[model samples]
Target: MNEQISLSAIKNGNINAFEELFRSLYPPLCGYALKILNDSDLAEEIVQEVFYQLWKKKEDLLITSSLNSYLYKAVYNRSLHLVEHKQVENKYANHVLNDNSEIYSIQDAMQAGEIYQIYKKTLSQLPHRCRKIFQMNRDFGLKYNEIAIKLSISVKTVEADMGKALKAFRHSLAEYK
Candidate 1:
């Protein structure tokens, strides 16, 4: 069956057509996602999520392009989102490590007040906007896109601010390591 026919079958709740589409499309979509994500497991998960969403929302979906095009676009977007989320998570982890690393051992670490003082001093060194973005990300656990929307800024701006903040932290906290 052709793409449109299979889609019609899907919209009509035809399980066999859905299965056929899954069998035909899953491999190439997974490969496409893998190229973008560079992790086999994450790529597979993204593709599976695309398929699952497709199945779940089959009724309202409008396939203007070829199903192949739609599926590929979905995979690409999902892969990018996953990469961005991972970047935010890594940045948060680095921030936590830098913020608390003065204590090399249980007995060697500074007192809580001293450590808080160091953290406060390091954070104060950042540019005002950069510090706020870093705080939203690290303290509030917001994703890059969420931070961008909250701040009414672009995602690229959020990323650049995060990079600047991390660089500042690394430069200031080098002594702790």
Candidate 2:
């Protein structure tokens, strides 16, 4: 049947004419939506929704063009809306991820600063020779042999001082762990 005849019948509340329109137009509408959406299921769903809306609002609907034009336009707009909505959701997700990474980096920097302060306080409590040896090894990045040579001390004495410094730091900083 012609679209005009089917549309007029549907407007007059003819169920058979409505069924005929659905049978004829449903496939082409789904195909059109599929071309826009790239998903068969979503395309079919959009077409079905448009048809449902057409039926539900048939009495109040105003069409200046053919029924085919109206349905195609509806499907096109709905597909575009879905794509826009998905893009917005993806952008929001990326923003949240970036925000979380920034927060994590700030927290890491603050924690490092706190640990450095604790370490400095602990170093102050060590005996002068132990503090110097630890600083030479850790802060100045010197080897044990280099520190021993620089300080005119035996390697064994440097090792013992390093051990004492480590024991002190571990004792004072254990609460953090």
Quality of model 1 by C-alpha lDDT: 0.73
TM-score of each: 0.49, 0.48
Model 2: what TM-score?
0.48
Residues 1-177 of candidate 2: C-alpha lDDT, one tens digit per residue: 777888888888888988877776677667665655567888899989998999988988899987867876787678667765663233343443435345223334334434555776799989999999999999999999999999999999999999999899998788775
User: At residue 35, what lDDT does model 2 achieve?
Assistant: 51
Q: Which candidate gets the maximum lDDT versus the true structure?
A: 2
Which pairs of residues collide in model 1? none
Q: List candidate 2 stretches off by more than 4 Å.
A: 87-177
Inter-residue clash pairs, candidate 2: none
Residue 173 in candidate 1, Cα distance off native in Å:
57
What are the candidates' C-alpha RMSDs? 20.1, 28.3
